[model samples]
Target: MTKPVRKAVFPVAGLGTRFLPATKTMAKEMLPVVDKPLIQYAVEEAAAAGIEYFIFVTGRGKHVLVEHFDHAFELEQLLGARGKTEALETLRAAIPAPGTVISTRQQNPLGLGHAVWCARAFIGEDEPFAVILPDDLILSDTPAIGQLIEAHAKVGGNVVATEDVPREHTNRYGILKVQSDDGRLARADGLVEKPKPEDAPSTLSIIGRYVLDATVMDRLGSIGKGSGGEIQLTDGMAATIDDGVPFHGLRFEGTRFDCGDKVGFLKANMAFALDRPDMRDDVAAFLKDMAAGL
Candidate 1:
C-alpha cells in the first residue's frame, strides 16, 4: 500500500513586491483575503484534507506568519470576558496542536523548488508530502489539495492540480504535455516552463497544489537552474517523469485566484467578502455605486 500523505509544506517565503508598502513589514502570505489571512486559508485547507504535519518554509520578516498560528492568551482572555464565544472559538481553532505546526527558514529568495528543498529535513524519508502556494487561493466545496490527495491515492504517483488556460496565456504558466486525457486526469509525458503559445503542447497548466512523491526531493537535488535561472519545480517534476515515474495532472474542482497579482487579489477580496452573509449586501451595493460613478 502507498503511504498516506501525512505532511504538507507551505512555501510562504516570497516577497510580495507587487503589494509594496502593505507587504513592506509583513509577509505576503499574511495579507488578508477577507477576514482571514492567505496563509491561514492555506493551513485550514491542508487541515481539512487530513494533513497532520504543517511545515512552513519561511523567510526573513515572516515572523508574523509564525505568530499567526500561535495562541494569543491576552486576546483570547479578552474575547472570553466579553462573551464573544464565536470569536473566541475561531481564534482557538486556528492553532494547530503543539508541535504539529513548525517553521524553517529558506534564507535566500530562491524559487519555489528551492523553498520545498528547505523542508526536506522535515519530510525526511517519510511518505509523500504536499506543497501549497498560498498565493493561489482555491475556493471549492472540496479543498483543492483534498482533490489532489484523492487523485494521489488512486494514481499512486505524483499529482499536480491543473486547469485549462487560454492558449495565449501559455507563456504565463508551466504548460503540460499531456499523453492521455480523461478530462479529470491527464497523464503527463512532459512539462514546459512558460512556453510560448505557439510552442505549447497543451493549455492545461500546472497550478500551485501538488502531492508529490519523496523521490522528487532527489530529483530537485540534481536539477540545476532552469527557465529563469532558478530551480523551477517544473524542471524537477519533469526529471521524475524521465525516470519512469508516473506523473499526472488532475483537473481540480475549484476556482483559483492568483492572489499574487494585483487584480486577482482585489477580485478575491471582493468575491470572498460578497460570500459572507454580513458583508454581501454592503459589498454589492458599494460595487454598484462604484461602477455607476465610473
Candidate 2:
C-alpha cells in the first residue's frame, strides 16, 4: 500500500532579497497576500488536504513565522473583552492543533533541496511527504496540494504539479521530458532544470507543489550543488527518475501566483483583493479607473 502523505514541509528559509527593505527586518513568508501571510495560505492548503503534521524548515530571523501560528494570549483576551467573538473565532480557526506544527532550522541558504533535506529527520522511511514552496501561491477550488495528493493516490509514485510555460520562458522553470501525456497526468521520463528554449524537451514546467516519496531524501543526500551552485530539489527529483522510479506530472487546476517576484506579488494582491466579497466592487472600480488613466 502506498503511504499517505501525512506531513508537509515548508521551505521558508530564503532571505527574500528581492523585497529587501521590507524583508530586511522580517521573513518574506510573513508578507501578506490580501490579509493573511503567504505561509498561512500554504499551511491552510496542507491542512485541508488531510496533512496531519506541518514541518517548517526555517532559518535565523524566522521567529515571526513561528509566532504567527502560536496563540496570542493578550490579543485573544482583548478581543474577548471587546466582545469580538467573530475575530477570536477566526484567529483560533487559523491555528493548527497544538503539537502538530513544528519548526526546524535550515541554518544555510543552500537551496530548495537543502532546505527539504534539513527536515529529513522529521520524515521517516516508508512515508511519503509533501513540500509546499510558499512563494508559489495557487488559488483553486481544490487546493493545489490536495490535487497532487489525489493524483498520488491513483499513480502511486512521485507526483509533481506541472503547468505549461511559453517557449521563451522555458529557461525560467525545470522542464520535463514527457514520455506520454494522458490528459491531466503526464508520465515523465526525465526532468531538466531550466534548459534553454532550444534544448528544452517540452513546456510542462515543474511548479512548487510536490508529493514525494521519502526515498527522495536519499537521492538528495548525494546531490551536489547544481546550476547556480545551490542544492536544487529538481536535481534530487531527477535522480529518482534516473533510478527508474515512476515519475508523474500533474497538470493541476489552479491559478498560480509566483509571489516571490515583485510583479507576481502585486498581481496576487490585486487578484485576491478582487475576489474578496467586501473589496471586489471598490477594487474593481479602482482598477478600471486606473486602466482608463493608463
Candidate 3:
C-alpha cells in the first residue's frame, strides 16, 4: 500500500550566513517574501497539498517562529476592539489549525540530513513524507508541493520538483541522469550532486520539494558524510537511485525563486509586491522612477 503522505519536515536550522546582518538576530526562515515569512509560505504549500502534520527542524533563537503559529489571542482581541476587521482576518489566516504544527530541535548544525534525522521519531515508520526547503519559493498557478504530490501518487518512488538549468549551472545542483523524459516528468537513472560541468548528465536539477518513501529513511540512516564534513542528504538520495527505487524530476509549471541567494531574494520581494493589488501602483511607480533615473 502507498502510505498516505501526512507529514512534512522543514529544516530551518541553517545559520543564514548569506544574509548575515539581517539573519544575525532572526532566522532566515522568518524573512518575508512580501507579507508572509518564508517559512509560512512553505507550510501553506504543504497544507494545500493535504499535509496533516507539519514538523520543523530548528536551531536556537527560533522561538519567534513557533510563536508565529500559535494563537495571537491578545492581539486578535485588540484588533477586534479597534474595529480592524479585515486586518484581523488576515492575521488569523496565517495561523495554522490547533495542534497540527510541531517542532523539534536539531542540536548541532550538522547538515540537511542531520536535521531530517532529528525528525525520525515524528515520521516513525510505514509512511511517505515531504521535505520542503523554504528557500525555494515557486510562483505558480498550482502550488509547487501539490505538483509533487500529484506526481507522487502516480510514480510512487520519490517525486521531486525539478527544472532545467543551464548545463553550466548544473554543477551547483543535484543533477539527474535521465532514463526517460516524458516532457513533464523525467525518470532519473541517478542523482549526481554538484558534478562538474563536463561530467553532468542532464540539466534537470533538483529543487526544494521532495516526497520520499519511508524506506529511504533507512538508507539515509546508514549513509556516511560525503563531499562536506556534514552528513549529506544528497548521498542518501543517490543510494535510493542505486537501489532501483524510482525517482522522477518533475518540470513543474512555475517560476522558481532561489530565495537563499541575495539577488533571488530581492527579486522575490519585488515580484510579490508588484503583484499585490494594494502595493502594485506605488511599487511600480517607484520602480519606473528608479529605472528612468538610472
Candidate 4:
C-alpha cells in the first residue's frame, strides 16, 4: 500500500551568493516575489499538496526562514488595535499550525543530499516525503508539488518533476534517461547530474520538486561525493534506481521561475504581480508603457 506523504523537507541552507549584497544578511529563500517570499510560495505549495509536517533544513543565519512561519504577537496585536483586519488575517493565514513545523540545522555547506539526510529523523524509516527547493517558483492552477504527489500515489516509488530544456542547457540539471514515456510520465532508466550536452541521456531534466521514498535517505546516508565533489541528491536517487527501485518523472503543468537568478527573480515578481486581480491592470499598463519606451 502507498503511504500518504505527510512530511516535506525544505533545504534552505544555500548561501545566496548570486544575489550578493541583498542576500548578505537575508536567507535567499526569504527573497520576495511580489508580496510573498520565495520560501512562503514553496510552503504553500507543499501545504496545498496535503503535506502536514514541514521540516526545514536550515543553515547559519537561516533562523528567519523558520520564524517566518511563526506567530508575530506584537505585530498581530498592533494590527488588531489599528483595525487592520485584512492585513491581520493575511498574516494569520500564513502561520502554520503549531507543532506542524519543525527545523534541523545543516552545519556545513554540504550538498543537497546531505541537507536531505539531515531531516531523516523527521521522516521515519518507512514513510515517504517530499523535498522542495525554493529557488524554483512554479506557478500553476493546481499546485506543482501536488501534481507530483498524485503521481507518487500511483507510481508508489519515487517521482521527480521533469521539464524539457534545450540540449545545450542539459548540463545545468539532472538529465533523465527515458526507458519509456507516455507524454506526461516517463520512467527513468537512469539520472545524470549536470551532464555535459554530449553526455546527456535526454533533454527531460529534473526540476526542484520531488516526491521520494524514505529508502532514499538510506542511499543518501552512504553515498559518496559525486559530480562537483559534493553529495548530489541526484547521485543518491540514482543509487536507489540501481537498487531496483522504480523512478519516474512527471511533466507537471506549470510555469517555473528560477528565482535564484536575478532576471528570473525580477520576472517572477512581474509574473506574480500580473497574476493578482488587484495589480493585474496596473502592472499590465506599466509593462505596456515600459515596452513602448523600449
Measured by lDDT, the strongest candidate is: 4
Pairs of colliding residues, candidate 3: none
What would the per-residue lDDT of candidate 1 be over residues 1-294, giving only the tens digit for each residue?
678898999998888999999888888998899889999999999999999999999988888898999999999999999999999999999999999988999898768898898898988674699999999998889999999999899887789999999999999999889999999999998999999999999999999999998888988888978888788889999998998878999999878999999999999999889888999999999999999999
- The regions of model 3 sitting more than 4 angstroms off are none
- lDDT for 127 in candidate 2 is 87
**Can you give the TM-score per candidate against the true fold?**
0.96, 0.98, 0.96, 0.99
**The 10-residue segment with the lowest total lDDT in model 1:** 118-127
Model 3: lDDT equals 0.87
Q: Identify the superior model by TM-score, candidate 3 or candidate 4.
A: 4
Candidate 2 off by > 4 Å: none
Q: In terms of TM-score, how similar is model 3 to the real structure?
A: 0.96
Model 3 Cα lDDT, one tens digit per residue, 1-294: 466788999998888899999999999999999889999989888888899899999888987778888888999999999999999998888788888888999989877877887888888676889999999998877888888888888888888899889988987888889999999999987888888989999888998888887767887788877666777777777788888888888999888999999999999999889878999999999999999998
Global lDDT scores for all candidate models = 0.92, 0.93, 0.87, 0.94
Order candidates by TM-score, high to low.
Answer: 4, 2, 1, 3
TM-score of 2: 0.98
What number of clashing residue pairs does each candidate have, in the order they appear?
0, 0, 0, 0
Error of 2 at 140 (Å): 0.7
lDDT for 211 (candidate 3): 89
RMSD of each: 1.3, 1.0, 1.4, 0.7
Residue 122 accuracy (lDDT) in model 4 = 88
